[model samples]
Target: MQVKDKVVIVTGAGSGIGRATALHFAHFGAKVVVSDIDLEKAQKVADEIVTNFGESLPIKANVAQYEEVENLIQHTVTAFGRLDVMVNNAGIGPKQLLKTAEHTLEDWEAVIAVNQTGVFYGMKLALQQMLKQGSGNIVNVASLAGLKASINNLSYSASKFAVVGMTKSAALEYAKTGIRINAVCPGYTESALLDKLLSARPDMDTMLKSIIPMKRYGDAKEIADAIVWLASDQTKFMTGQTLILDGGTSL
Candidate 1:
């Protein structure tokens, strides 16, 4: 176990990429805090972790709220004694695809609230705890869209691009302070998020695959594996880096 007994917090752990990351952390012997907007889903993942491998706690917090995000970090430290790893994995896309001109104010705001502001909250709180502890690892989830423009994904692209900027800026500021920060930009992963996207825009399924030279989507577990590896000491020399796991699509 690369991170034996390390206390790790994963936001948006109710389902999709978040759930998979939480479970992977637990499997490698980390104490995981499964945090989600839905307490029930968080509890289920935490319960599964307790049943199978390491210890876990379920926490309900809307990442869009600063107080809730603060509480999530505070609670994890109170229960586990320290914060070693933090995965800012909570994010949202717009409810419906709209062009730049047709986008509603509400839709844009909602996506920014969670995807951008939420990530900021998690990183700030985790840093407060880690700066005191003198070391930590932070992994923010970005998207291939962050690397370039995507069709029908205006708000999401903007938010994810902001995340990328945040990750790099923080990593530079703390490069020598014993904390490492990085981001993972995934492309067309297999998760509830992708399912919903495909469901809403059936044409997207075909359109999304056309750009991938590999002609395949990534798995949630695959993304989780990258997050886990980045959190480990094995990658101590790496920071301010955006590792794009997009099945060679960026190529």
Candidate 2:
């Protein structure tokens, strides 16, 4: 689990799970690239890493755009020479939940652009660099909604399911090439995304907790730990698998 000196890139590294993952990877002595659509936030995270005696580089890139993601990879390689692990963690959901029929095409497209197509670009571009290096790891951040249907989150659910599928498919295609791809499906985690959802419907918090056997929302660091583990040599033999850290919510 050392990952010392490995070049790692974490998209959406500005806050929440993404931020935690960046810090965690840096903690393990990895040269981390903190990428996000928000340059200010990304830089702040990078500064924090530096303050903690870690190496980090903050770059701005919206994962939804192909060129930006391409530039992100390029900038990373320019700075670190090679990419060892890529965390496709940037994603967004509708501000308000809506039934499938009530979801507008605009809403669906927006979520899909960031959550699904964004992952495709990340994986494709990252694969190109990894292939040259002959060894690399990829970790996708999906959700419990991916494995199970959500009540009123058609776009989000669909996008995450696509992520899970893509992770498995890509993992198989690159299985023999020293490139391992996997996904982490987290449930009810204490992220800014969850805070927004709960803010909208305060009562939903209690309802959500009641359904989880753990009776508590997971900490961001908890999920970050799992992502780091999956990306480390300890799980070198693992690939094409979805590691669920939802406290039995999927069960």
Candidate 3:
């Protein structure tokens, strides 16, 4: 249950919440596997962990592709001997105005492929390994939009909702198999993604703060801490649950 010495894989660990979680887990002594589409960014994170925390592995893989995801899992197992935890966190949120329903089918397909199918692939492969080991944890990174409808981005919301549903369904199916599955729904976190959104509409920054009780964005570390706890022994009795770290925004 302790994070120490456990082999953990975090996808999209190059920046934002993914990077924070990778560093946090490594700091706690987990054998961290940092996978991202950007090889340079992944390596940077892995280097930092190795320099400060002693051990880490960097791998470049696109989560949206089944073959890439399979290879990521295979490589991690080959290197670490066993996979203890898998964090499905790689995603994209390209903003599109509903007024412009003229959006291409390609864009919609790309978003769903990465956000929804990526999680599905990660869960499927991770569960396979965990079932063999008779124990493992899977923590998915969903969004607040998954819980409620977000204006302007219909595709992102739908994809995230799928993540939430998949998390619950997988948890029920594997409840007796010693593999725990759960999700963390974060809202308005300080990340590159959010920064891009805010830059597009600076007024949204204040508007968001006014709506949330906290009056500010949540930190990446806060989300990372929640993930670690959910993935650790502290939540052994919990599964198929979605932990919302939205600073009371959803309240």
Task: Report the lDDT of model 1 for residue 246.
Answer: 89
Give the 10-residue window scoring lowest on summed lDDT in candidate 3: 95-104
TM for every model, in the order presented, reads 0.98, 0.99, 0.97
lDDT of 3: 0.92
Model 1: per-residue Cα lDDT over 1-251, one tens digit each: 48778899999998988999999989999999999999999999999999999799999999999999999999999999999999999888888888898887888899999999999999999999999999999999999989999767788999999999999999999988899999999999988779988998799888889988889999999999999999987898999999899889999
Best by lDDT: 2
C-alpha positional error of residue 228 in candidate 3 after TM-score superposition, expressed in Å: 0.6
- In candidate 1, position 135 carries an lDDT of 96
* 1 or 3, greater by TM-score: 1
Put down candidate 2 lDDT per residue, 18-55, tens digits, no spaces.
Answer: 99999999998999999999999999999999899488
Number of colliding residue pairs in model 1: 0
Q: Give lDDT: candidate 1, residue 189.
A: 96
